[model samples]
Target: MRHDPLFERLWDGTAQMEEWTAAVSHGAITHVADNIITVHTTYFCGSVTAIRTSEGLVLIDTAKPETAKQTLDVIRSWDDSPIHTVIFTHGHIDHTSGITVIDQEADARGLARPRIVAHRNVKRRMERYEASHGYNSIAQSQQFNKPGYIYPIGQRRPDAVYDDTLSLSVGGERIELFHGRGETDDATFVWLPERRVLASGDFVIWVFPNAGNPRKVQRYAADWATALRRMEALAPAVLIPGHGPVVFGEERAAEMLRHGAEALEHLVRETLALLNRGASLDAVLHAVKVPEAYLGKPYLAAKYDDPEFLVRGIYHFYAGWFDGDAAHLKPPRTADLASELAALAGGAEKLAERATHLSEAGNFRLAVQLVEFASAAAPDDRAIQAIRAAVLRKSIENENSLMGKAFLAVYAREAEQRSKG
Candidate 1:
């Protein structure tokens, strides 16, 4: 409470976010009726999406493992009805963790262990958790709200897996699973033929697709584009996205998918062109542009993932690490260089002052860039705390996207803790 800039900035952003944030719409557990009971997940907690058919209930995505009890609480609210089947759209912790809870509940209550469905690659993806969980933590630290974050690791893996495609008949309802390479290598989107509901998973987030989560591992912008196009083709009337409110009607669904698809395609097309032209990584990063044409598209607007992250992701997708120079191969340690930068900027205090000024002037991105160096060099400085708070506040003001808001919130909080001590 000394200053509370980080939380203040985030709070301000949330206040101004009515236009960008998906209308709550009982997203915590909204029931979308279209011969299908689509349970829309909220932002913080896990959501259990289910489709009841004559054959059985086809549940898409279990909840988080730690919150599986809470997820069960939500599910029980809807129906004490047994979970018939589940489709893990990807192997991410948020989507895959709650399977066993649902499974255990179903079993104890004399319900069948829902046919766990997922892409074949999900096994290998899960193995990453088993093999290098520490590595996952480091990588995920950038995007996730660290304090709010809890890993749901020990859960049952999917029993059924498919590569290109899989078709399931639930109580005479046909649900098609298409393998999609997006945010992760093992991703899938479900298409229901009879009900006209598509469980798009993370493939079509209400805001922008998360193709550019700054700290996460490799993300597929092009492949994400491919998947979005595949989803658009189905022309489902209702869309139950992995996060956010359920989108109703074919027209809205088409527009959402189309806008998201075009944005990714635009970024990928331009990024690939820059790479093909022998531009330096820095040059390619700078040269890539989010098309002016698509800027006005509602879903295409920068809200969750920005084009910069996508450009960097695509750069890695093609170039593979080396930035076309030898010096980067043996780059200086981050702290050492940061110390030098702080000194050159006339110490952390001077940089902090400049950052505060820049924040006042509406240059939050640049302000954070400068302060990150100062903060890293002088981690214990109270001046760094004030600057970080200012940067966070400005970031909230300038943030056209959720990615910016989240990144700003995280670092600001970290700086606040440093300030506390």
Candidate 2:
């Protein structure tokens, strides 16, 4: 394997990865090992791993369609081997949408189309995605801060699907696939025993694991921890993660795997302990906090998903959506409730004014809630809309998680538009 100085620094933990984007965004092709190369297109896009076998090239993932051409070009520059196999770690659009480009490339080159493989649930997920395209588009727009992001409806079905575990011998190297419920139920992480490399899908992202995305489906925190433990047991020398730079060296990769698993396990244990004590969801949400020890680790920072959100998800996983509040079990319509609250407070304008005061006092959380009620009570009120927008802007500024910030930003933008009207 050719040695690179940057890779050496990263492998030995000498690199300063305090800035996550700086660590993950290689922005080009990185020669990982003798026959392995990692194509890191962008921070948001998933990284693609190309493994060269005696027979052909095997791609662990294909990035989003927007970066497909560039990703392909990067891969071609490294090794123009006929891609015999393409693996989908999950059915997320960012990881799987680029298959069309690969298919077209194969057709143009007069080579056989790469065989696509994924967990069985990925096929079902793709079907669900097509059915919920419109809703997903709106959710994506809000989550990604894109004004009018449209989720592509159709996704190509995988050529083959496996359940639990599957092993394949490609080019005399044993490649094993294991199913784990992490960021998605359909997640699969590939293990190359010969090279001691683990192609971890979104399971091993650079930031805190996205075990709870408020805008998306459920995530299996416990299962994700178990998967990481399983990977750690393999003792892989190289780890090609789903979205970050390729991790080189066994102990360094093992440390990352262990820390990530422990972080998720801690959250799961603490949240469940609170729930088991018959605590209300509201109580659990506020009480269970991410340990500072975990947050201090650069890899475990709450940049993409908040721990509070994960606690809510855990509550949903074990308990019901009722939050153990009788009033919430059979609540009044939001608009009706907001209107009543406004009336009790003397008017929507009064609520808006109070929201502004709370925001100015550095209580953006409570300020946003009050502003939301004011807006719901008087959706057409310019003063309320302006206040709502202002409060949300402050909330966004105070937010740490990208997902939370984007959602708040979306609401702020809408409120700003309403204020203009």
Candidate 3:
């Protein structure tokens, strides 16, 4: 019961990317023009867009509640004009939860309430969050390392919603909202015709399209790419993503969207081909890769979501958990497998020792895992303390990838429970 060695490798790959992630988040939007404004939101996330003559004060996605407030605070410093309209590029909590702040500000100023808009699926998404609050919270906590997903549910519904495409003049600016799929079911990208500015949500992360969030539900990579190509066709001068900094020029923006979309489409198409060939799930996951050239591109980095994770998502949709091999329908229990592996490695003590050294080598994730297996094998062993301590140190060191950081944080938390017992 060695388990899939690839799974172990996935664990390592996930760990090794932490340093790369840290270096990437450092990219920032330092300045914005008179027509453009950048909001350094508290979701600890950032978003930017240009206010157009047609639209008084147009906004991309609103950050988390606190961050939304911070953004609004910054906006007040500028032209206190009411937001002509607000767009929720997707249903992520950070982007969708701040309508009330805008509503309140508009009310105080007696300015026309800004129109809230998004893809048609946005309402259902917001409702799902309302209904499954606890489930979302737990999943989010694991991914973002947040204390809890509990937040005051804001009753904000998009004032205007559309299915495929919606075009209008807000504050006299011609804006368009087009639907596509990538990170979430209810996702869309907005384009400002005159300004040549595009506000693409998670569809285009500065790095990779967050096409595969293991913790989230279904994602559509094909449509995601289609959406990107559509935007690239528009030839936007400025590109404002859901997260990270803005793309500087029209040609630059087009290239970024084109590559990001290519990365998504490439993974999806490659994944589908493997699925069509009846390849095992593991084979598909291992086979799909966004060319090294794409990975090395300045805009297409691994700061937000990596491509491999998205590849796994496409594979999962085509085929369930089974590897297409009947033997794996119900493999032996994970704990039982761990026990057998532990015995082979000279019992739990040896595994724990090895894991510690791996942690020292900056392989914090592998270290925690080996420690986990060893601890599972012999809960009462004294090495458990040292093993748990190594996990603590590693988690602390992981600041790059949110999930990698969360991995260690969660493990340390669980280890504490073991200690208490």
Give the best candidate by TM-score.
2
Give the range of the ten consecutive residues with the poorest summed lDDT in model 1.
Answer: 1-10
lDDT: which candidate is best?
Answer: 2
Give the per-residue lDDT of model 2 (tens digit) for 1-421. Answer: 4446755654444654434446444457767777888888676788888889988988988899888888888888888889999999999988998889999999999999999999999999989888888999999999899988999857678999999999987776678999999999999999988789899999988788998899888888999999999999999998888876777788778998999999888888998998889989989888888889887776677888998898888889888677988899888999999999999999999999999999999998789989999999999998789889989998888999999999999989999999999
Ranked by lDDT, the better of candidates 2 and 3 is 2
Predict model 3's lDDT versus the native. 0.70
Question: In model 2, which regions exceed 4 Å deviation?
Answer: 1-27
Rank all candidate structures by their lDDT, best first, as comma-separated numbers: 2, 1, 3
Error of 3 at 236 (Å): 1.2
lDDT of 2: 0.87
- Tens-digit per-residue lDDT, 1-421, candidate 1: 1213332333234332243234332334556674456443345433458666765667788766556676667557766666677899998877887787777777788867877889998888888786777756654555554654434456677888899999988777788999888898899888877777788888875556778777777899889888888888888887877765566778778877887788888888887787888777788777888776665554455767778878888888888988766668898987788898888988877777887788788877678777787887888887688678767767777777666776677777787777878
Error of 1 at 361 (Å): 3.6
